[model samples]
Target: MIETDKNQILLNMMTDYAKNNPDTIFCYTNAAILYETPRWEELPLEIHTVQSNKKIKNRTAITHIRPYFKKSKYKGFNVITLVDLLLELAVNDTEISAISSISHHLYKNEISVETILNYCQSQKQKSGVAKLRHLVSFASRLDESPFETKVRLKLYVAGVIIPVQQHQVICQNKKKYRVDFLFEFKGRKIILEADGLIKYSSNVNERANERQRESDLIREGYEIMRVMNHDFENGRFAQILENYGIPKRRYYGKKIVKKHY
Candidate 1:
């Protein structure tokens, strides 16, 4: 789990940057957070300005607004809109899955996919336009988490049949449980859950209830596979997938994206 201090850390960074560069606009994740609380991971501060003299120092990214964007003339310290941030993510070659998750959050709430697409389409000379379109191709409002998106990408890359996400299952006892992902293969019912640190606590009763819930699903013949958030590290994540007999496959996407986190 991210510490509450992360919000303060981001604020401090923005405050320090805005102090010296008054004309510069806090864009990217900084702008996104100004509009709404963060949904995924925290990122470094990004700023944009019409001035070309201000060079980006360590830990901060800088973009210069060209004449076309300058004509629009965004006002205030947070001049970049969500659409601008989306375009910046595209131009910056952000990791594909992270981009998808961010796109999901923005489009599902305050923006439309078409509005983003239309913006991209109109920006013929924009650096990240094509890249943004590729990233958005994988985006949907159904996104739940960055971890889930990573799981989906891993499944896609490994040539495995992607499990049904947010699947509903009814036990014989008349209780209904919503699962993260469900996979059915060769008469076997598999329930895959990705658990973050937020799921675990020191409370004994909570753990007891979790065990009981699993027992109920087990009694109904549904096999449970719980994946901790950290399990995605090292080779452990790949091993878990192979253990489930998901066949390995080659990746087909053209973009070469490295994770920002």
Candidate 2:
């Protein structure tokens, strides 16, 4: 829920605008909230009618579909401006970590860091430019999921060198596995695994398969570590890293404590 009164007022304000202006195409944050990333139900948005055929919305909800919620960047491709999206994210009273997660999706699928940074360069005087820039710094296309992105941000704060995402390693049986994170410290191969439940919740056998996979990696001279959602949230994984004797650039107590920590 969007707990801010200002955001509530904005949502009502935008909804009113959308109601009054039928056939309106909400742009930027407005469009983004209505379409792809609806973090809050009540977000202040500026609803505008781009074209009669583009989109139409009312007080009840948005209508006419524009998936991806972006302006066209290529021939017949629907794309949102990277800067616009990130800037809106920064101004929405959102936590930096949440904003980083959102930015990760945008970076992974829609835009490149160079492109977004170049665009940000032009928005120097914008209201949320500073926060937007910071959030973008944590954005990574390599993260396969939002949990990975969250882990990555914590790692950054802990001052650990970011790991290589989805790193492929060859095992003793001549099999190859794409690990979640990989770091080389003190000339040792350390693998950090983000153990999200969806990876194995569907079947009991998936868990067994995972253990076997880890066993294989260990047999081939790789030091392995695993973290679940709770470990990342509470920062307990940092202690595990210390216990394993991984070299860190900094000593952060209960901090990150992953290649992505």
Candidate 3:
């Protein structure tokens, strides 16, 4: 709910509160923010905290009264352990949301899949342990954004061949380029780009730079497919992949019914 600027302000307020109240520990999303976990979005309405003593009555914050397995200090603030934050997210958020959050932090090297698995193993009887256990195997540290994770998950669920994320390729000109997603088909190297309009179209120079980069990649004999946010919203990504001859891994459940072009 909080925009970028507002989110920072809210976090600062929560940090100040944590510093003043030694008996309270920031947990859940609050702690995730303090830990600098990537792609972890906090609710703007309430600051999440865990009370170590008497509960505080506050409208802007939600207090959790529970025994945390571990605690740590980050930026001079008492915060819940990273493992606890992951488990909290797993239980509180949706499956994909939880997976994406964990994957982002993993990609940032703030946590490890093994650590999460170990925690899940120790808490097998917990509320979200089963779901977390199931999703952890699919989480990748290579995914750079929640959007990319969503795209990858959709492709996987539809039985499409999994592609490499943040793939690096050396161009003929001796310059290296990193692609969002890369696949190989019929001996052709294909690059799939997930483009966020705001990020790419912020200014004229940025747009031109991206175009030039794509041109260079194409010149290097790689087939490039640029997919926008709307494409996914309109179910166009599947058609795009199918047109490129990306073979399906296996057929189950409702098949990806191809539309006539």
Candidate 4:
């Protein structure tokens, strides 16, 4: 198991022990915690209950037995499987949040497209199965961050040509630079960067390295567009893409409510 904080350590130990018992199954966010999946939210203190034949008296854990439960082992530990965990998340969370969490696993190569698709296919007439199918179709293994996945999905939904994610280009000096998004339009190479404040401002060396990397890419005929989290939050990304010749396919027609005569 990966080294984590004290609380997480305690939670993991509890779940690990729970796996040994036959009556209870660790699941949902708790399953995710045990599996060490990348998540957008902080780890909750309460354990998520998947299945139990008897009442669990632990107050640190939340129990929900509504949706059906299944037990499986991952890496020799008995916990809820990834497919079931994803289905639960899809039913409970927003579409984007579900996609983002799944994307993190895909990006890390911890999960595969075929594996998810196969699992989704096995569950017929299940709630959230259709939505999971659609969401999984948009899942890209190349996304390095949640922001990158969001931007890529937006571009895809808007009918714009999807840029290559994490494209690596070798500079003249034999150094390779991997860009977040790379688009080739009308013979111009454009690079889109999702600039997070923590990544760029955490250290002077990091900032300097980024500057040098940008300068090298620019010298090699690459046009760089750096976008922060606020740009997407404020809905400025579409305009930014439009400025660079990406066509918008989504049309927002003016609302026309029917009037009573």
Q: What is the C-alpha lDDT of each candidate?
A: 0.59, 0.57, 0.64, 0.63
Measured by C-alpha RMSD in angstroms, how accurate is candidate 1? 7.7
Cα lDDT over the full model 1: 0.59
Per-residue error for 175 in candidate 2, Å, reads 1.3
For candidate 2, what is the total of clashing residue pairs? 6
Q: After superposition, how far is residue 212 of candidate 2 from its true place, in Å?
A: 2.5
State the lDDT of candidate 1 residue by residue for 181-233, as single tens digits: 88888888888887755656889999998888899999988888878767868
In model 2, the runs with Cα more than 4 Å from the true position are 1-82, 93-99, 233-235, 250-261
Model 4 weakest lDDT span, ten residues long? 252-261
Q: State TM-scores per candidate.
A: 0.67, 0.61, 0.68, 0.68
Q: Pick the candidate with the highest TM-score.
A: 3
Q: Over the stretch 112-172, how does candidate 2's per-residue lDDT look in tens digits?
A: 7677677768878887666666666566677766567666666667667667888898776
Q: Where does model 1 exceed 4 Å of error?
A: 1-10, 13-77, 103-108, 203-205, 248-261
Ranking according to TM-score, highest score first? 3, 4, 1, 2
Model 2 C-alpha lDDT versus the unseen true structure: 0.57
| lDDT tens readout by residue for model 3, 1-261 | 336565566567666766566444344323443444323344433334333334445412223212322434433344455666666655555556667767877886868988888888898878767667777877789887766777777777768777888988887888888998888867888898877443464688988888888889999889988777677766687889888888876554432221220
The better candidate by TM-score, 3 or 4, is 3
Extract clashing residue pairs from model 1: 91-128, 158-249
